[model samples]
Target: MSTPALQHIAAVGAGRMGRGIAIAFAYAGHEVALIDIKPRALEATAKLETESLAEIGSSLRMLADLGMFDAGELPAIMARVRFVGLADAPAALEGADVVFEGVPEVLDGKRDAFAFICEHVRADAIVASTTSTFLVTDLAAFVTHPERLLNAHWLNPAYIVPLVELSPHPGTSAEVVDAMKAMLERAGKVPVVCAAAPGFIVPRLQALIMNEAARMIEQGIATAEEIDKATRYGFGFRFASIGVVEFIDFGGNDILYYASRYLAQAIDPTRFAPPAIVEQYMEEGRIGLKTGKGFYDYTGVDPDAYRRDVLGRSLGMLRHLDLLRAPGAALRPKE
Candidate 1:
């Protein structure tokens, strides 16, 4: 028999990430309450939630048709969700096993949101944050139950992506950590325990590479599209499977040394040197992947074309990597 949905899941701030996360829990058969500050925001969230769920349901049907799932399960999964607002958040979470806070990235906002939640939630409910940067310990300061507040950072579009870094505050109890792990595992996520730090691990690593890529483009060393293409086609595919160190080992240290030394010198390596916001997007003229132009053109191109192109390349790389790593497949245990 399939696992039952998480009885009660509370999600605050039904914006992009919030809506996606709420839908993820709902899709997994949990009843979700999505809270927002404004009524209009709540309305928008509900509409987006419907659209997201429909798209997700269609995808699941495709998988089932391909023999990935038995017949007639997706609808039942969709049926298990509901949404609410801040005033109702506490009531909805009365006996909630887990509460996922996807509030604004700002510190004061999250503190207030959690403070309100702490007043309403049951003592046993494990309050988890989907924060990208704010320190968990700091966020926990607003709540009486710091031990229950942990950072469960899910990659964008949480459903499809499997990596979730579960970083707990210093006060978080072992039981709370384990409960959070079990909750995510039941939802089919690959949860990694990480120490609480700025950007945690994946974000920190990705930002480093992405920052360098941005600097290269800004300095006219390469176009934004060229940098992205090179990264994805050249090392991106390989790194997904083998990881950096393993890829270095496979390529032999000599070639690695040469590339690192040459590339490092060619590009700025001040490390977080270029300001983040300035480098986040390409120059106004260089807005690729949007406005029907970037390094490529999409004036008359079907929007879905981009998705198909990306999916094709990514899936192929993943398939190849899986085959290569099958013999040694296992989770990396935390130190």
Candidate 2:
């Protein structure tokens, strides 16, 4: 039997991240109480709620128009997300199964948010800080129950993005991580656990790639349009079919080893040199797919079937991008 949806979900900080997270949970068939950390007069709170709910309603309508659900379901979906002002946060959070604290990026702001959260949230509540700025360790000192705290780094437009990067510190409970994973999965999210490192996963990798893209432009390696085109047709297309490390294995680690050496020598060794693991793998005869080993073991896998599946995925991407053509079509001159 499938797990039942979470009983109570609360998102603190009714701003963009809070609103997005609230919509995501509400769309998953749960009512989410969205509370703003900022205090205001009753009239101001009412105004904020009115504007915030309007935005939420419009966002839901936009999603519906995109065929996320029925267009007519907007009212019902919007009704699931209720806004709570600072005055009502304690009562609103009393029984919350999971509380997402997305107050702000500043350290003082997080400390204040946690102090408020711990004072009212139930002892068993799985409290998470939806912070991309601070690691779980950074905020743990402010929490009453440090084990309940971890970082649930949601990408922007949280309702649409499927991935949520979960970073847990050493003091975090194993069960809390599992519970968060299960809860997120039940809400149709993909959760990947990573160490409490700066940039987590996607951000760190993208930072390097994005900086390189900018550097290429600065160096006049390619025009902006050409760079984007190449990325779409070549770099992005290839990675869409296989992961970075997986691609290394599929293409043979030996290729990267030599290419790295050549680039290091020709351009800049500091920038292009391969990590020690690559050279060590080559020395150990664990080169790649042909050698039956590399970053991942392929001992029991059927090579031909894997090859076909990868080809099919790559072809699918090309087909989607409208770049697929008859074999050797590029080789023939245009009429």
**Which 10-residue span in candidate 1 carries the lowest summed lDDT?**
272-281
Off by over 4 Å in 2: 1-5, 324-335
- Screening candidate 2 with a backbone cut-off below 3 angstroms (N, C-alpha, C), the clashing residue pairs are none
Instruction: Output the number of the lDDT-best candidate.
Output: 2
RMSD (Å) per prediction: 15.2, 3.1
lDDT per residue (tens digit) for residues 233-262 in model 2 = 889999989989899999999999999999
The C-alpha lDDT values of all candidates are 0.69, 0.89
Root-mean-square deviation of Cα positions for candidate 1 versus the true structure, in angstroms: 15.2
Candidate 1, residues 33-152, lDDT tens digits: the string is 766644456667568557655665665666579886575776776566555655466677675767788877888888787877788877777888898878787787787767777889
Native-to-model Cα distance after best TM-score fit, residue 7 in candidate 2, in Å? 2.6
Would you list the clashing residue pairs of candidate 1? Answer: 288-294
Per-candidate count of clashing residue pairs (backbone under 3 Å): 1, 0
